[model samples]
Structure formats: structure tokens, C-alpha cells
Target: MYVVTGGEMHQIDRYTMDQLGLSEEILMENAGQAFVRHLLTSVSIDEKVIVLIGAGNNGGDGFVISRLLAEKGFQFEIWVVPPVERVKGTARFHMDIFKRCGYSFIEYEANSIGFRESLNTCSVIIDALLGTGVKGNLRKPYAYVIKAVNESEKRIISVDIPSGVPSSEGEAEVYGVIANETFTFQAPKLSAFVYPSALHFGEVHTLEIGIPKIAFTEVAPQRQLITEKRVRTTLAKRPADAHKGKAGRALIIGGTQEMTGAPVLTTDACLRAGAGLATMAIPACIHPIVTQKLTESTFMKLPDAEGEIRSDVLKEEISYIQYDGIAIGPGMGRNISKPIYEALRSFNGPVVIDADGLYHMSNELHRWCEEPRSGPTIITPHPGEMALLTGRTIKEVEEHRFEYTLDFAKKYQMYVVLKGPFTIVTTPVGEQWVNTTGNASLAKGGSGDVLTGMILALVLQQHSVIDAICNAVHIHGKLADKMIETHDIFSVKASDLIHSLPRVLRSYRY
Candidate 1:
């Protein structure tokens, strides 16, 4: 689905009313009624609901919901946080109609007898005090209401995004309501998919209001939420009589004596990701250990210098290897970056630059921008590596993750896989995909190594560069999701992801 920011969503809302010829009131009515349907299925009508109403259309949605509940013989209390007169426009119309229907509200005051009494009486809380337009910290009566709702220990359902969660950029207020569920209208807010604020949105349900499909198409949000179906469709179908040579060859070049496991993990993931042939080239000193751990894949022991791969050894051995795709980094140490760059600078097939490989590229990004590669080069960088590449603080890159990644890819004419809780994959032209399948299970060490290998395997299979990156990212994260079903997140290590790849791929088989 198309992922939009708050302003973009507002434009879609406006276009629905103005261009599609749907009245604003009918749209509001549609939103409220649609939400009420979902609410009814999840909660019982016998429970008492306290609707926290504000001065905006979000509050108007609450009024409509309260009116519907009253009609259904469901007991509910409407508490207007701001003065009733502060409500205006389409919202005012809904409020006036609700009052005309003989429904009255209790004016909520901070720590007041009536407020405390309402909190004590209600079994459910409907948070409609703030919507997509929340800015800064929780303020005034909204703050007081959020505090009371949180303290109530009642099941909370937030209208659109949770109150105190900013729909725009930046972190959510720690005081935001932690709802049992969030029923969002139209598309989900960008914050709904990202962190800090995402923690506040419990079970998110997107309700389709009366917005025309054309509005969404016209707005054309560059961001998208990756789904399983998308990854499944992007994968290449192997023939019944397929041979090892036909599948594709993937080369993983990295590993010092100290960090030998990193490259082994990459090789393990490469073959598991469906590569026909996988090779791991590490320092000669570590070959004995890696050989024992990895039996199925071939190994190339580059000449060692101080227990690290010598740059000259890589240059000499690379000429002999005939691989379809290369994944460089993982544990390549700082010494071999020159040869890694030299190898990538001339090669034609898809190359995944990651780990220490990116550390070197950070120094030569200016050169890369001037003389771009003809073939695809995918860079997988966590926030720390990205900070080194862009010369920005880690916090700066984290705050504007999408924007910074898009800029880097566009400027250098390469695809960038910015790794995080929500992994963002962007092409040089500005199209982006955010994979929402991962959990905290992937935060452990060597996760990116496995991901690099997966991307290499897909790219070697001749999938489009963008398709390969997106599919690999989705599958990698999806494996983590599957792991957490039967195992704890803390116990899901990088090797576990490799072990689970077959299960993930089996579900996608036709």
C-alpha cells in the first residue's frame, strides 16, 4: 500500500471531497461509521466506553461514534476536553447534530472529581483528542486526558494515530497513549511504520474512507509498505530440471582471522537464499576454521598478511573466479578495502557493498559520484556506517533516514539499503520500499552479513537490481518474524535466520 506523510494524506482527504464531489460531512460520516464497524467486531456493546473528544475532525469522529453507540443501546460517555465552542467547520456540524440528538457531554477537567469518576467507571477509552496534526509535546487538556486514559488501565482504541503521536517526522512524546489498537482512516501515517511512535500504535487497522482511488494515484507517495505477495512475485521460478550451474554463482569476499565467522555466515545465507554456487574467500590463516564450518560451499584462501587478506591476493584471485554476483564486506577489515574497491571499480555484474567495504567507500564517495558504475552496486549500511559515509551524526541520519538514503542513492547512482527496524530500500531515481516484516530479533550481530548474502543470491539469479534488493530485504526480515513465532527474539541469532530461509521460501513456492 502507498505510505504517505500527514500532509500528503490531508491532500488525499481534500481531493476526495473537492475533485471526487464527495461532501466533507459525508466523508466524515463514512470515516466514523467505518471505524464503528471494526470497533463493534472487536469489543462488546455491553462495555461502557468513554470517548475523549477534542476540537477537530478527529473529535468529530468520536461524536459520530458516540451517536452510533447510543443508537445501538451501547452505553458510552462523551467527554469534551476543550470547550464545546472550540469545535468548528465540519466537526462543528457533527457536534451540533450529536447535541440535537439529545446526547450531552461532560467537560473534562484535570484531576477533577468528574474526570476521576469517569475514568473509574469506563471499561474502554476511545482516544480521539489528537489526530495526524499533533505537533511538539502533549499540551493542555490533551495532555491531561492522555495521562488519565493511560492511568485508567482500560482498553484503549485510538482514532487514526494515537493521541500525542506526531504524524509528521520526529519522535513521539513519551506521554502518548499506548493503545490496544489504532484504527487509522485512509493510508497509515509514516510514523505508524517507524519507531518510537510505532511502539504506541498497537494493532493497526487501516479503514478505507470515501476517498477516490484516483486521489491516491495522483499523490503518488514515493514510500510503500512491502508485503509478502510483493516479495513472492519478485522471486525467480526455478525449472524442474534446473542444474547448479543454471542457478547462479555468488562470491562473498571478506573475513579476517579475527572476524572469520562474518564471512561464513554470509556464505551460509547465500546458498540458503537459493544460490546455485556460493564461495567465501577469506585470509589463508582462517581458511581451516571456515572450511570446517562451511562444507557445501567452495572457499578461496587469499594470501594472508598479519592475519588479514592481503589486497594483492584478492586482485590475483579475483581474476580466476567467474561469479555472477559479488558481496564484499562482512569482516573484510580496513586493510583490504583498496583491493575491494579496485575489484568493484571494474566488475560488471551486481555487487553488494556492505560492512567494512562501506567504511572504505565513505572515503571515496566523491570519486564514486563523478564516475558512476554502469552495472548495479547495492550498499547495505546501518546507521553507523551511513553516518561515516554521509559525514552526518548518527542521530541526524536516523531522524531523516528516508531522505538521506534517497539523496545518497540519487547522487551516486546506486541503490542503498538503509538497515533499521524498518529497512528502507531506495533506487537512484527516488522510488522507495519500506520492509515492515522485521522484529527486534534482527538487531543482533551479523544480521547485515546474512542480508548482504541474500541480496547477492537474488541479484545473481538475474532479478532486476531493485527487485533483488527489495525481495531479499523482505525475505530476510520475514524470516525473523517466523523465528519469533516459536522462539524468543533474544534467541534469534544470525545463523538462525540462515536456517529459517528454506521455510520462508517454501511458503512462497507455487
Candidate 2:
């Protein structure tokens, strides 16, 4: 599940060969055989194959694959860019073997019309023109050949990393080859998860290319892809004798007169995520509206001076509510009322501060973190909100998500969920988890409210803060993915994600 950069992967390959005593040729053979297996099984081999080889080990892989295909009686054409003579080391060795076996090779001369004709005639194209080691913009015949192959409208398969991709940042700065399927070695690369580069890597298959297990263990990656197996193992199982109160109770405080749906979404998500009981403390005026919206959850009407929760009433209710966990600030407007501050100062349980609540805390962040009642606080902030809290711009926060998240968590002694493309959940214990779930469909309104509810539900259920956040995040994305299985992501609504939660939870065996 570790995601390494292109450079790290190259070092890992070398270490495996030198330290572990694994032969480089055997690793090449393993990679070639695995790719051939996937190609033969996943796609048809009845049509002619046109493989474009460069002058590196990636091209060596292409030569081995071409040999395997020819041995299997498959018709194919090998096109060596810069000619076979320019290929060196392992690539040169393989090229010699191919020539001796009576395989025809086409020397790519910068302006060969036959090259274009062969490309157009082939049914499939193998892109071994570049590997992960490629950096900066491509030049000359390589770029021209890549552009020509892309324009051919044939099924393309890229070996290792796609040609012209930067590999780690996931950005396609220049021209990048689009492959129908990409066969990566060892583990999934960083480029496979990031934006524009991810688009070109279709149906990625991570093949085990004869690297020792110890190498992976020694080089731990910072980012990871969340899988169903990982989620299944992390989920806690309920005992048959468990009771409702034993599962834990959660109290959510949010919602004003106009944004009554925010607290409702949070409470509903909590219930669906298996909270034993859920309670909401809303403004006295909006209490009836929230009650009507959510029949399953209990509601308390807090003092409201101008259609918002009065801080005085928050203090009064904090002593009476015997909830295990509390979630605040979903739709609570940014009103600097004295009552709101008083109530925040009084609550003394594990609290999840989000949305406008996070905005309010930015000014007196140190006091909020060092308060006597602050027991296990978690702040969920998007890039903009994070910038407000950390005194940085949105661009700065995005570029240094890890550093900022760690700094904020350590400073406040709290858990911080930095929400974005890859949500970073950092704990005060110096451990960080990057959630690789969810999708663009979650960009809709009320989605954060849903996440807040899910996290509160797990925390109230007595799960560790880290585990709760991790589980909630995984389920949040799984629900969206499940919905996308039947509905379009653009059309998927926030409420649809809430409704799918029960089914998604039930799908988990634990």
C-alpha cells in the first residue's frame, strides 16, 4: 500500500539486485512475463502489436515482451527509437537476442513515413519509450514518436511509468502518453494517485517484479491507498450482548434558523455509522424545524437571542448532557456573540470543532487548545479554513499539507483533519494517516457535515480518535464510490451519500 516516488523506486530496484543478490535479468523477465500475462488475459492478441522501445531498461522490458509474444506465435512489430545500436547495457543485450532470433526491427529515423504507417496499422501499441526516471520535458524523436503513437487511435499500454510523466507530483507538465492500461512494478507510484498524471494511467496493475519484501519494509512511504481489506481489518466488531448505551451517545451542536439541515445531516450520518444514540442542541427558534427534519434523534432547544444558540444556554446545557462525545460548529454562523464563547469554554468532553466553529477558534486558538475543559479536540478544516487557522494562504497550505498539519496538531495537542484531495488526519501522538478515499462527488454542500457526523459517531462509540477518523474517512469515500457504481458523480447528492451509509456499513463483514 506504500506509494513511492520514481527516484525511490529506482533505488529500491538497485538495492534488491545488489544487496539481495537477485539477478537484474530475472527481474526484467518477471516484469515482462507479468505484463504479457495481463495483456493476454485483459486484452485480445489477435491483432498486430507495435512496441516502441527507448534506450533504457524500460526498452529492455519491451524487447523481452516482444520475444515472449513471438514465441507464442503472436504477430508483432518492434520499433526501436534512435535505432538498436544506440540501446545500451541490458537493453543492448536484449536487442542482440531479438535480432538473432530473426525478429524484424524498424529503425526510427526522425522522419520515416513507414514508422507512421506501421503505427497506424498496428492494433495495439506498447509504450516503453520512457520510465519513471524521466524528468523535465522530453525532446526530439522521443516526443515526436509519442505524439504520433497517441494520434494513432490504437490501444496503448505503458511499461513502468507513462512516457512524459513527472512520476511523483502527478502533474502532466508537458505532453504525456495516454495508455489504456499501465503496468507498474512493485507498488503504485505517487503519480498514479495525483491529478492529470492519474488520468493517463488507466486501469493500473501493480505487478510484483521480484523485489525482496525486506526492501519494501525498509523504505516506508508517507502516502497510502486505502483498500477494502485494510478497512475490514480496522473495523471493530460488536458483541452479541452489547446494549445501546454501551455503544455510546453523541451530542451535536450546530444549525441556525436558515441552515437547519447541517445538524440534521451530521446526526443522521452518526446514526447510520452505528452510534447508539444522537442528540442535537440547536437554537430555540430552529429546534422545531430540526426536530421535524430528524425524527430518530432527540433535540434540545437551547436559549436563542437572535435565532442562534445563546452562549449562556450552552453553559447551562453542558452540565446536564451526559454525552460521551460532542461535535460543534456545522452551520453555526460566524456571530461573535458572548454566549457562544462562554458555551465553548464550558464544554469539557471530546469535541469536534468544524466549519464556522473552526473560523471562530482561529483568533483565540491558543486559549482553546490550552483550556481546562479541552479533552481530545479535533478540528476539521478545508484548505481555506486551515489557512485562516495557520495564518497562511490556501496555496501555501496545499503545497505543504504535511508540514502544516503536523505543526498545527503539535501546537494544539489535538487531532487535525486537513481536508482536500487526499485528506491528512494527523494526531498529537506524532502519527499521521493520509486518507485516500472519497472523490469529487463529495464536493457538494453538506458533505463536510456528513463527515463530522461520521467521525463523532465513531468517537462516541468509544473508538480511538485516530481509528475513528480513519474508519469514517474510508466509509465516506466507499459510500461515494458505491453510489458512483450506479449514478453519475456529478448528479450524486449529499443526501444520497447519507442514505447509502447503512447499506455501505452493512457491506462490511466486521
Candidate 3:
């Protein structure tokens, strides 16, 4: 589903009414009726509904909803925070109609204690204070009314987005109404999925307000909500005659003396992700440890110097093995290793760099991506590591994740996965896929390694680089969510996620 910003939604509304020839008043009626229907379905009509409306079109919507409810014998109170004189255009028409129907409307002023008293008396409050067009910090009567309503212990439902919440960035900058439910028009906004604002949005339901499909299609939003239907449509089923060799082979290179578990997790996750064969190359010292952890895959014991794989052994391993994709990093120590650097330079396959490998690459990571023989490469970096690699502060990266991820992918000509709350996968062509499935349960150690392995496995399976990253990100988060559903997030380990991958994949079967 397309995620529109406030501006885009406005354009969509205009296009729907002007180009599609849909009457504005008819659209308003549908919106009001849809909202009233949602309210009737979600809550009791017997409960007193106090609507706090602004002086604009949003208020017009509330007025219509109030009129519909009053006509249906549903007891309700309408409090126009701004006086009826302040209402303009279509809003004025609706206000006049409501007055004609003998529905009493209160014109609240700055010092009206009655507004607060009414809010307190109502079982549910409908906040239509401000619409998507609201910009910056709210001021005056609207802000005061929002604050008052929030203080009231009533179940609040917001029209469109929550009042005072920015629909684009998901930031509630100043005094936003927290609604128990938000009935948005058209489609879900980006803010509803993004962060802090996502928390305040509570349970959101989109009510179709008669916006023409052509309008939205013409305005094609760059951002989208990742739904199960999209995932199911994109995933390809295996051919009946497919063989093990055709399924693809993946190699994971990492794990030093003290961090044997990292490579094990990556290798195991790759196998669970359906790689026909998965192998790991670790420092010879930890070979025995990693081998003991998983007997399903092969292991390569690279020559070790100072208990870490050195660059000298890279040529030997690259020559002996031929794999479809490689996953590097994940507990690979930062110290200079000649064999490791050699393998990084010599390997000619899709590469997924994560954990310590990204740390080691640092400024040189971009250079490696620019290399002629480097196949479709993907760097999975959390905020700190991305900051280190790009020489930008963690704060800078977090603030402009979309821009940075896109820029870095284009500059390096490779896919980039900037992992965080909404794990973003940016392709070289500047397309971005934001995976919304994951949760805080994945904030544990070695979780990134598991993701790296999953991506590498998918890439080796001959999926497009973008598809591989997107599928891996979705599956990784889905597994974490599954784990959380079964056990407490605090108690779930990264290893548990690796164990649960098969079950998650099985459930995704169409």
C-alpha cells in the first residue's frame, strides 16, 4: 500500500475531486459516514461522544459525523473549539446544516470551563482539531483544547491522523493528541508506521473517503507498507525438477578465537534460509568449536596467525572453493589479517558484509564496492557501524537514514541495508524497501550475523540482489516477531532466532 505524506494526500484529494469529477460534498459525506460506521463498529453508540472540532474541513467532517449520529438516536455532544463564525467554505455549510437540524453546538472560547467539563463527562472523545495540513508547533485555542482533551480520561478517536502529529516523519513535536484509535482517510500515512508517532497512533484503521484510484496511482508514492500479499506475490516457488546444485551454495567467512558463535549463527541461519549448501571459513583455532556447533554444513579451517584468519590464506581458499555467494564479518576481529584482505579482494561473488567486517572495511568499504569484479554486494550495518563506515555521526545517520542509505547505495553501486527500527534496503538504482516486520527482540548480539547469513543464502539462490535483501530482511524480522510471540523478548537469544527460521519460513508458504 502506498504511504502518502500530507502534501501528497492533499494533491490526491484535489485530483480526485477535480480530475476524476467526484463531488467534494459527496466525498465529505462518504468520509463522515465511513468514520461514523467505524465508530459504531468499534465502540458503543450508547456512550456519550464529545467531538472537539476545529474551524476547517476537518471540523466539517466532525460536523457531518455528529449530525449522522444525532439522527440515529445516538446521544452525542458537539463542541466547536473555534466559533461557528471562524468556520469557512464547506465547513460553514455543514455547521449551518447541523444548526438547522436543531443539534446544539457549543462555541468554546479561551476561558470556557464547560469544554473541559463536557470532555470529562463524555465516554469517548473525537479529536478533529487539526488535519494533515497543520504545520510546525500548534498554538492557541487548538493547542489548549488538545491538551485538555488528552488530560481527560476518555477513549479518544482521531479523524485522519492524530492532531499535532506530523504525518510524514512520525514525530509528535508539540502537544499532539494521543488517540486510542485513529480512523485515517484514503490510506495509511508513513508516520503511522515509523516511530514515536507510531506509538501514539494506537490502533489505526483506514476509511475509504471516495478518493479515485487513478489519483493515487498517478501520484504514486515512493514509500509503501510491506504487506503479506506483496511478499507472497514476490516469492517464487521452486521448480519441480530443481536440483541441489541449482539451489545455490553460500560461504560464510568470519569468527576469531573468542567469537566462535558468530560464524556458527551465520552458517546455521544460512542453512535454515534454504541454501543448498552452507560453509564457514574461520580461524583454525576456532574451527573445532564451530564444527561442533553445526554438523549440517561443511567447514574450512583457514591458516591462523595470532588466532585469527590472516590475508595470506585468502588466495589458497579462493582457489580451492567456488561458491555462489559469501557472507563476511560477524565476530571477525579488527586486527590486520593478510589472508582475510586477500579473500576480500579475490572473491568474485555476491558478498554480504556485516558486523566486524564492516568495521574493518571502514573508509575502504566504498573502495572495495567500486572494484571491477565485486559482484552484487550488500552491507548490513546498524547505526554505529554505518556511522563509522561513512564518517558520519550516528545522530546524522539516524536523522537522515533514507537519504544516507540511498546516497551510499548509489555511490557504491551496491545494495545497502541500514539496519534499525525500520530496516531499510536501498538498491543501486535508488529504490528502497523498508522492512517493517522486526522488533526489539532482535536487539541482541549476533542477530545481525543471522541476517547476513540469510541474505547471503538468498543471493546465492540466484535471486536478484534487491529481492535477496528484501526477502532476507522480511524473513529476519518475521522470525524475531515469531520468537517474541512465543517467549519474552528479554529471554530470547540470537540462537533461538536461528532455530525458529524454518518454522517462520514454513508459515510463509502460500
Candidate 4:
């Protein structure tokens, strides 16, 4: 589904009206009716509904809802933030219709007698004071009204978004109504995804407001919310006649003596992700630990320098391994940074670089960007790691995550998966995808290692590089979601995600 910004939504709306010949009145009417339908179905009928109106299209929606509530014999009272005569155009038309329907309304001013009574008596408050057009902080009487609504402790259902949230980005105003539910038109706004602003829009419901489908097609939304159906379609179907060799072969290279579990998790995840065979190449010191823990995977002992992979290990192994894909990092300490780069520069197969492997490439990102390679390379970095690679503060990395990912991917000519609540994947050419699945359950050690393994297996299975990365991200998070359904979200382990893969994959399979 498309995730539109305020400007994008406005362009689509204009296209709907100008090119498609859809009248604004018809669209407003549809929006109002949709809001009423959702409100009536989602909330209790016993509670009195108070519809708050503004001077714009959102208020026009409230006007429509007020009239519909009267027609349906539901108890609702309308209140406008601005004077009644200020409501113009399509909104005025709706207000006239509401008046003709025999419904009464009161214009509210800060600390007015009627406003205070309405604030105190209403059980359900519908906030339509603003739409996606909100500008800075709330001002004057509008701010006072919003504060009153929040202070009243009434259940709020906002139209489009919470009134004081700027549609562009960031948090809602301190005075903005903390909605219990938000009914948005067409697509979800960007504010609904980004934090602070996102928190204010509690339980969003995207209602179809009769905008032509062609409008969306013409607009071509750049941002999208990942859905289960879409992710399921991206999954490659398993052939009944397939053999181990045909499935794919993945080589995992990482693990220091003390951090042996990292490569172990990666290799295990590769097997669970359907890699036909997985080989773990690590320092000789950690080979015993990896071998003892991972019976399914073959182990190759690389030269070690104080329990870390030797800087020359990749140089020695490059000619020997015939794997379809390689996963680097995980627990490989910083000692052998040169061989990690060697593996990256030399490997012709898809490479997934994570953990310390990313740190090794931190300073030489420009070199990696310019180097010629046979297959796609993906770098998975959390915010701190990304900061190291970009030479930016952790705060800067987190704040401008989307921009940073796009720039790094486009500049370095590599794919980047910046993992977080909404993991963002950007391609070398700047194509972006935001994963909306998963939860806090994935915020654990070894999660990124598992992700590397999953991505390596998919790439080896011949899925397109972009599709491979996206599929791995979605499946990685989806497993966490599935586990949360049956287990405590807080107690979820990285290994739990690996264990849940069988069940998660089964659900996605036809």
C-alpha cells in the first residue's frame, strides 16, 4: 500500500478532480460518509459523540458526519473552532446540508460556556481541527481547544490525523489531541509512520474516500507500507523435485573464539532459510565451538590470530570455496579487517556484510562503492554502525535515516538495510522500501546475523538481489511477529526467530 506525504496526497487529489472529473463535493461527501461508517462501527453507540469542526475540508468531513449521525438517530452535537460563517466552499455546502437536516451546532471560543460544557459532557470527541496542512506549533484558541480535549480525557477519533501533527515529519505538538483512533483518507500519511507524530495517531484506519484508482496510478507513490500478502508473493516457491545442491549453497565467514555464537546463528539461520548446504569458515580456535554447536553445517578452520579470523584467511580460501553466496561478519573481531575487504573485492557471488564486517569497511566505503564486482553486495547496519561508516553522530544517523540510507546506497553502489522499528532498505539507485512488520522482539543480539544468513540464502537461490534483500528483511521481522503471537515479545531470542522460520514459511507457502 502507498504511504503518501501531504504534498503527494494533494497532487493525487488535484489529479482526481482536474483530470478524472471527480467533483470535490462528491469526494468530501464520500470522506464524511466513510468517517461516519468507521466511527459508528468502531465506537460504542451509547456514548455521546461530539464532532469538532475546522474551516477546511477535514471540517467538511465532520459536517457530513454530523448530518449522518442526525439521520441515523445517533446522539451527536457539532462544534466549530472558527465562526460558522467562515466555513466556505464545499465545507459550507456540507454545513448548509447539516443545518437543513435539523442538527444544531455551536461555535466554540477559548473558555466559552458552551465549549466548556461540550468538553465535559461528551464521551467521544471527533477531532477535525486540521488535516495534513498543519504548520508549526498550535496557536491561540485552537491550541486551547486541543488542550481542553486532551484534558477532558475523552476518547478521541481524529479525522485524517491528529490536529496539531505537521504532515511533513517529526512529533505532534504537546497540545495535540492524543487520539484513540484516527480515520485517514486514501493513503496513510508520513506523520503516521515517523515518531512523536506517529505516537499521536493511535490505531489508524485508512478509509477509501472515492478517489479514483487512476489517481494513485498517476501519482505513483514512492513510499509504501509492507504487507503480508505482498511479502508472501515475493517468496520463491519450493519445487518438490529440488535437491540440496539445487536449493543453494551459502558460506558463512565470521566468529572469534569468544564470539563463536554469531557465526553459529548465521549458519543455522541459513539452513532454516532453505540453503541446501551451509559452510562455516572461522578462526581455527573457534572451529571446535562452531562445530560442536552446529552439526548440520560443515566447518573450515581458517588461520587465527589470537582467536580472530586471520587477515589472510579470505586470500587462502577464495580459490577453494565453491559456494553460491557468502555471509561475512557476525562475530569476526576487528583484527582481520584486510581479508574481509579482500573477500568483498574478490567474491563474485552475492555478499551480505554485517556486524564487525561493516566496521571493517567503515573507512573504505568509497573504495567499495567504486570497485567492480560480479554480484550484488548488501551491507546491513544498525544506527551506530551506520554512524561509524558515514562519519556522522548516532543522533544524526537516526534522525535522517531515510536520507542517509539513500545517499549511502546511491553513492556506494550497494544495498543498505538500516535496521530499526521500521527497517528501511534502499538500493544502489535510490529505490526505497520501509518494512512495517516485526516488533521490539527483534531488538536483540544475533538478529542481524540471522538476517545476513537469510539474505545470503535467498541470493544463492537466484532471487533478484533487491528481492532477496527485501524478502529477507520481511521474513526476518515476520518471524518475530509470529513468535510474539505465541510467546512473550520481550523474551523473544534470535534463536527463537530461527526456530519460528519453519512455521512462518509454512504460512507463506501455497
Which regions of candidate 1 are displaced past 4 Å?
A: 109-112, 172-175, 314-316, 335-339
Compare candidates 2 and 3 on TM-score and give the better one: 3
Winner by TM-score? 1
Candidate no. 1 TM-score: 0.95
* Candidate 4 pairs with clashing backbones: none
Deviating ranges (above 4 Å) for candidate 2:
83-86, 170-174, 310-317, 337-350, 364-377, 386-439
Q: Candidate 4 lDDT, tens digit per residue, 1-510?
A: 778878889999999999999998999899988988877776666778888899988889889888888788777778888877778998999889888877778777633666867678878899988888777777777888887888888888899988988775533233477898888998888767666567788988999988878898898876676677776787776688999998888888888977989999999999998899988888888776677788998888888888887777677655534777888888988865654565567667788889998888785666776774656788999999999999988777776777788889888788899998788888888877878778998888988888989888877776778877888898899898888888997899999999888888788775
1-510: candidate 1 lDDT, tens digit per residue? 777888888888788778888888998899899999999997898899989888998988988988888888888888888877788988899998998999888876532557967788989899988878777777777777788788888899999989888775556244688898999987878887666778888988989887878988887778887888887788877789889988988888889878989999998988988899988878889988999998999988788788887767766666634877888888988965455555667778788999998987787777788888777889999999999998899888877787889899999998999999889998999998988878888999999999998998888776788888888999898899999999997999999999989988788765
Q: Candidate 2: how large is its RMSD?
A: 3.3
Q: Each model's C-alpha lDDT?
A: 0.85, 0.80, 0.80, 0.82
Question: CA lDDT of 50 in candidate 4?
Answer: 87
Q: After superposition, how far is residue 216 of candidate 4 from its true place, in Å?
A: 2.3
Candidate 4 lDDT score at position 121? 82
Model 4: lowest-lDDT 10 consecutive positions: 166-175
Candidate achieving higher lDDT, 1 or 4: 1
What would the TM-scores of all predictions be?
A: 0.95, 0.88, 0.91, 0.94
| Model 3 lDDT tens row, 451-504 | 988888877766667776788889889988898888998887888988888788
